[model samples]
Target: MLAAIRSIIFIPVFYGGSTPIIILAFLVALFSESGTHFMGRLWSRYHYLCARLILGIRVKIEGEIRNEPLLYVFKHESMFETIDLLRIFKKPVVIAKKELLVIPLWGWIAKRHGLLGIDRDGGGAAMRQIIKQARKAVAQGRPIIIFAEGSRAHHGQRPELQTGFAGIYKLMELPLVPVALDSGLVAPRDTFVQKSGVITYAVQDEIEPGLGRDDIRDRVHAAINALND
Candidate 1:
C-alpha cells in the first residue's frame, strides 16, 4: 500500500514538475546552447529528488569519478542510472539509440546539446557516424557514455555486449571507464513499481587505450560485472 501511494504521488509530481523544465529547456536552447545542458541537470536532479523523497530510494557512489576525457561504458540495468548519469558527469555527450532522437520535442533538445544518435541496425554507415561523433565529442573534452550491452538487462543477468562497443573503443582511441550499478533491484526494467533501496554506482579501474579488441572487451566486461559477482 505504501508503494502504491508513492507511485500515485510520484508519477504526477515527477512529470508535472518536469513539464515546465522541459519547456523552459527547449526555450533556453534557442538562445544559448548551455541552457539545455543546465536544464538537463535540473531534470535529473528533480528525478533524484522524487526518488529519494517520495519513493525512499537513496543513491550512493563508490570510488572516485576520474575527470579525464574518455569513454564511459556503463552496466545496462534500468533507467534510474540512465538519468542519474547525466548528473554524475559534466557536459557528457550520450550516445543514444536512434529512436530516442525522434521523440517529438525532446529529441530536438537532445540534439541541440550534442547527444549522438545511434543507428543500431544501419551497419557500417551507423558505425562511421558514431565514431565521427565520438571523436568530435572527445576532442571537445566531453566524456562519451554508451551501454556495452546496448540495452537494459534484468538484475543478476549478465548479457553479452553488442559488437559495436569494440568498434567504438578502437575508433575513438581513448581511455575507458567501466561503471557498475545495481539499480534494477530498485527501479527495474519495464515495470511501474519502484522499491525503496540504496543503489550503488562503482567506478572501476581505468583501462588504457591501444589495447587489442578482445583484451579491452574482456577487461571491461569483467569490470562492469564485478559488482554482480
Candidate 2:
C-alpha cells in the first residue's frame, strides 16, 4: 500500500538523518544548555515535518494554548505526541516514565533540562522525587504536562487516570488543562505505517484548582477523551 511504502522510506530518512542532529545536540548539551534547547526544538520540528509531509498526517489544534504554570494532562494513545512536544507548548516540563531517564546521553540532557521522572514501581521514593521536581518546575514558571493514563491506550479506548495524576494534582494545586487528540488514526501505537488523517487536539477550558478528588478526576477524564472518537 502507499502508506506502507511511505513509512518504509520515511523511517530511514527521519531516523537515520536525525542521528547526526541528535549527536550534535548531545555535544551542544556538553557546553551550552541553550544550544541543546535549540537542538531539541529542531529535532521536534523535524519529526513534525515528517509526519506532515511524508506521512500525509495533518494536525488541527482547537482551543487556546495559554501561557501559564498549570498542569496539562494529554490523552495518550500513540507515541506521535512524544515527538510533537514543542508543538504543544512553548516550554513544558513533561513528566514522563522514570525509566526513560536511563536512556544514555538523552536522559542526561532531559535531567539537565529539568524533566521530572516518574518511577511507577518505585513507590514512595518515586512520588517524592516527582513532587519535588514538579514543585521546582512550577516555581520556575514552567507548565507541567503529563499523560494521565500513564501509558498509551488502543485507539478509541478511554482508560481511567493513573493514581499518580491525582496525587500530583492535589499537591501542586495548579489549574488543570486537559487535552484530547486523535493521532492514532494516522500514527498508531506499536506500528510504523501511518494512514493519512487529520489529527485533532482539543484543549478544554481550564479547571480551577482545589476541587474534590473525585470531581476533578471525573471532569478531566471526560475532557481528555473529547476527541478520542
Candidate 3:
C-alpha cells in the first residue's frame, strides 16, 4: 500500500514534473548542447531523489569511477540505471539503438547532445559507422557507455553480448570498464513497484587496451556478473 501511494506520487512527478525542463532542453538545444546535458543531469538527480525519498530506495557505490576516457560496459538489468548513469558520468555519450533516436522529443534532444545511434542489424557497415561516431565522442573527452547484453536482462540472467561490443572494442582501442549493478531486484524491468533497498554499482577494474577480443570478452562477462555470483 505504501509503495502504491508512492507510485502514484512518483508517476506524476517523474513524468509530469519534467515537462517544463524538457521543453527548456529543447529550446536550449538550439543554442548549446551543454545546456540540454545540464538539464538532463538535473532530471536524473531529481529522479534519484524521488527513488530515495519516495520509494525508500538508496544507491550505494562500492568502487571507484575512473577519470580516464574509456569505454564503459554496463550490465543492463533495469531502466533505473539508464537515468542513474547519466548523473553518474560527466557528459557520457551513450550508444543507443537507431530506433530510440527516432523518438519525438527525447530522440531529438539525444541527437543534439551528441549521443551515438547505431543500426544494430546493419552489418559491417553499421559497425564502421559506430566506431567512427564513438571515436569522435572519445576525441571530445566524453566517455562512451554501452550495454554488454544490448538490452535489459532478468535479475539473475546473464545473456551473451551483442556482436557490436567486440567490434567497437577492437576499433576504438580504448580501455574498458565493466560496471555491475543490482537494479533489477529494486526497480525491475517492466514493473511499477520499486522495493526499498540499496542499489549497488560495483565498478570493476579497468581492462587495459591491447587484449584479444576473446580474452577481453571473457573477463568483462565475468567481472560484470561478479556481484551476482
Q: Which candidate has the top score in lDDT?
A: 1
* Model 3: CA > 4 A from native: none
lDDT of 1 at 110: 86
Clashing pairs in 1: none
Q: Give the clashing pairs for model 2.
A: none
**Model 2: what TM-score?**
0.95
- Listed per candidate, the RMSD to the true structure in angstroms reads 1.2, 1.4, 1.2
TM-score of each: 0.96, 0.95, 0.96
Please report how far candidate 2 places residue 73 from its true position, in Å: 0.0
Q: By summed lDDT, which 10 consecutive residues of candidate 2 come out lowest?
A: 83-92
Residue range 97-191, candidate 1, lDDT tens digits? 88888998889988888788888899989899889877887787888988988899998888988888998888888889999989988888887
| Model 3 per-residue lDDT tens digits across residues 1-229 | 7777887788887888778877888899889978988988887898898888888888888888754579999998988998887788878888988898898898899888767889888999988888888788888888989987989987888888887788788888898999999999888888787778889999999888888878888898898887788
Q: What is the C-alpha local distance difference test score of each model?
A: 0.87, 0.84, 0.85
- Residue 121 lDDT, candidate 1, scale 0-100: 90
Off by over 4 Å in 2: none
Off by over 4 Å in 1: none
